[model samples]
Target chain A: MTTSVNPLWRFRGVAGTAWFAMVYLYLPILILIVLSFNANKVATIWSGFSLQWYSVVLDNPNIMRAAKNSLIIASCATVVSTVFATLAALAMSGPTFRGQSVINAMLGLPLLAPEIVTAVASLLFFLAIGMELGLLSVLVAHVVFCIPFAYMPIRARLEGMDPRYKEAASDLYATPWATFWRITLPLLMPGVVSGAMLAFIISLDDFVITFFVAGAGATTLPVYIFGMIRMGITPEVNAISAMMLLVSILFVILSWLVGRVKQ
Target chain B: MLSASVRRTGLLAPTVITLFVFMVLPMGLMAWMSFLEPGTYGGVQWGHYSAKSYIQFLYEWDLDDQLVLNTDYVGIFLRSFLLAGGATLATLLIGFPTALYIALKDEKARNRWILLISIPFWTNLLVRTFAWMLLLRNGGLAEQFLSSIGLVKEELNILYTPTAVAIGLVYSFLPFMILPIYTSLEKMDWKLVEAAFDLGANRWMAFRRVILPLAMPGIVAGCMLVLIPALGSYFIPELLGGGKSLMIGNLIQNQFGASRNWPFGAALSFALLTVVMVTMIAYNLRFKRAPGADK
Candidate 1:
């Protein structure tokens, strides 16, 4: 402990800085939430607290449609991404092969590469295949990005698990598939879920790829928010965003709770 | 040997095929497309090829007004990097203490603190960015609260500026930094730490000597994870950036969007990909490592 430095300044400064940073980081979030309840229709001015914005957002058919589209896309993407990721995880950890090095590098590409690159490629791919840019396109595109997130934590979980148990199951008359289906999947559930959750979250928020790959009629929520954004700041955007924040926070909380319960 | 090999291959077949088609093929095609010209109908224009599209962007299309063209791209690229780099540095600085505090604390504290850190990750990035838009805009909370006092007289619009963009980028990406650093810090060897302290090193010295080096891999991983994609972030700068300037992401988007010059955009995309791939290769070279290496 240095006696030369004043304890009071150090103490207050550290606490103050930390508190300020946290507040600064979170303040906009708080403000958005607060304004979402504003009774006034206009965003530039505020009247009073109101739940009308929430109702308006909910009551709007477009919002509901976009929400449904998002939910279906996310769920499908999660399942596909989780399944493929498990395969990739098994590949990366189970055995090495000639293609192993190539797969490893490719597995990380989406994680590291720019969204625009893949977004462009996805658009081109669909075009080349004569597939219309619609729900299916977005679903496949989202899944492509989600696989790496799914692969990572699940791989970690597989690595951390006791191999002897798997071996025991294999020795007992359980087929490799059966052992994996029962023991491996069960033990790896948390990582799989975590990965799925991460994948879902990412798919839900992805705008860049979603923006380019989506057709005009298939406007996802993110694309909707982005399109509306060009019109300048408004309360509807705030109201919609606040609702989205709630949706995301809810998913995050659910995932965390699920993780805790399993633990 | 052959039978076991076949067995392993059978087990891994689906993963190999799925990854090859979706992951490997798309990237391969993109790399291939980079060399070719983008067709008008959004496919690659075959047989009309040169590196002209790429060269044009790097040299700013040989402008009459060099300063103006340079400002448009060179300046914007530099600004974007600076902003992303600044955000990365800040995340590291702030995330280090928070991660250390959590990792060093008791079990209860660790759980609570980590939960707090993670709650924000679930919220949509767009929503999160929008939240900042709400706070930073004119007559918003920050401006109103400040002006209500004597801190600011005229209304200050903090939204749609570089600083606002930085705030959103930093806020969004901070967790990526924290998670890895926390992992590294939590996995630090307790005995080495104690040994450093016992060997007459102070807290700062012990930390510097024993903790920082061990955490370098995670730090490097976290920074790479945060900074690379951030350079191509369209939304953060788009909404917060207010369409004021052109980022590489935005530029790529423009070529693909209204500009209708897919070749030029693809060329730029290749530029970003090349930079990222080279850097990642360099990173892996420096640390051809696995987890728990030091341990």
Candidate 2:
């Protein structure tokens, strides 16, 4: 602990500030989670712990439809983006080629561009092309933004991988396709899985772009929750928010774990 | 068996096509839409070039159809800039210490702290903003707690104000600030700090001269990350500001949704994009990254 030498003088209140900051960060989330289980109709008041709110969420037809839409969109977005990202990562992993920097910048553009801008642009694009703004439009938008998220982890994983294994396989007269299948793919699975998980969560949790692009009958969970929130808070909103938080947190942790696992 | 170059081309095709069609093409269309006349109903009028959308940012047509300077849209842009700037500063003040504390920790504890920080970031932005809505509303937890503690008699009346929106922005983007600063500080060479101390530099001096310069790259990155999103945030200002305070985002949405002015909305997006790009380019030029800090 070299830092212990000046802890008292140098970073006087930093540790305390970190503690306070953590509490500040988690308190609202914790309160929301706890209140989600409250038996009372009012969201803030506590009568007793109850599972009725969760049941109410499950029973609500609008929420269920939104949830179904969310899952379908997230799944399709995750699969498509991850596959495209995996292909891009595989190609870009080999060597620096002409226009590599340009390609890299383009890939990151979706991430760097403001969501509101992208949403507005996408809305205009769909309208200009005479494409109906529905599930398909939202899906197209999700896959676009999600590609960079899916690409980054996979690219990182490939960068960390020992390339000699693939070389050694190819040197043994194994075909390029065989070497990719037998050697590279297994090595990249963790990155691929983690990337897919990240894409899924991002798509599932998206609000801004989805809100703009989604037309009638194409509401996702976050969009539905936003509407619910606008209408006013209820115990049901809390429950659904809690559940959504759980899903995202679980996936993040799972992605972290997968990222840490030995390749 | 495919050649490596052939495989590269094949593998890269999807990404190129997807980005070109969806990202580049849409952005181009938006740029064009920003110049075209807005349609009566909603969309833009094709081939009708008009700079009125851009001009309308500072000027509006009066009864005589003459351009008159209007600060309404500019006011929203200014408010958004100030709010985003304030949020960036707040996050830095809070996040720097948090990041420094984590960076000082040993490996196991460091990982735990990082994960804790990341969870909130990965969580839904709407949910996080909504949580603030619960706390800041009239008679909500914050106000109730203040009253319960005999702090005040009157209502807090913080919700639906710019202050509430500021709080949400700081809270939502704190992690973005922390993570980048942590990334930089984590890779810092602590020996530099020790050398400064050994050379008779006091704690504050060491921090100012040695530690801060090293963390500059991260700080800059964190500021950009926070500023950009904070500038464009719709939900935080919408739900928290209660429509009293309008940021660039809500203003743009209003143009599209209720005002039915697609060209103006697209123009606002371009204006926002220009601000963002200028910030990014200026920062990149000013802050030459510390060598090996990323490693």
User: Top lDDT: which candidate number?
Assistant: 2
Please give the range of 10 consecutive residues that has the lowest summed lDDT in model 1 chain A.
Answer: A1-10
DockQ of each: 0.42, 0.71
- Chain A TM-scores, all candidates? 0.89, 0.94
Residue-by-residue lDDT tens digits, candidate 2, A1-263: 43544553348889898998898899889888888999999887778999999999999999999999999999999999999999999889877899888898799789888999999989988988899999999999999999999999899999999978988998899987798799999989988988998899899999999999999889999999999999998999999999998888887887778667753
- What are the per-residue Cα lDDT tens digits for candidate 1 across B1-295? 3575676677566656665676567666666666677676655687777775755554654446452233456676788789889989988887776666566656776677677677776677777787777677888777877887889999787788888888888888887887888788777776776677678887777767777888887888888878987887888888888876547787778877777776677767777888888988998877657555332
RMSD of each: 4.0, 1.6
Off by over 4 Å in 1: A1-18, A170-172, A175-178, B1-7, B35-44, B59-71, B290-295
Best prediction by DockQ? 2
TM-score of each: 0.89, 0.97
Instruction: Please state the i-RMS of candidate 1.
Output: 4.4
Badly placed stretches (over 4 Å) of model 2 are A1-10, A258-263, B1-3, B288-290, B293-295
* Residue-level lDDT for B123 in candidate 2: 91
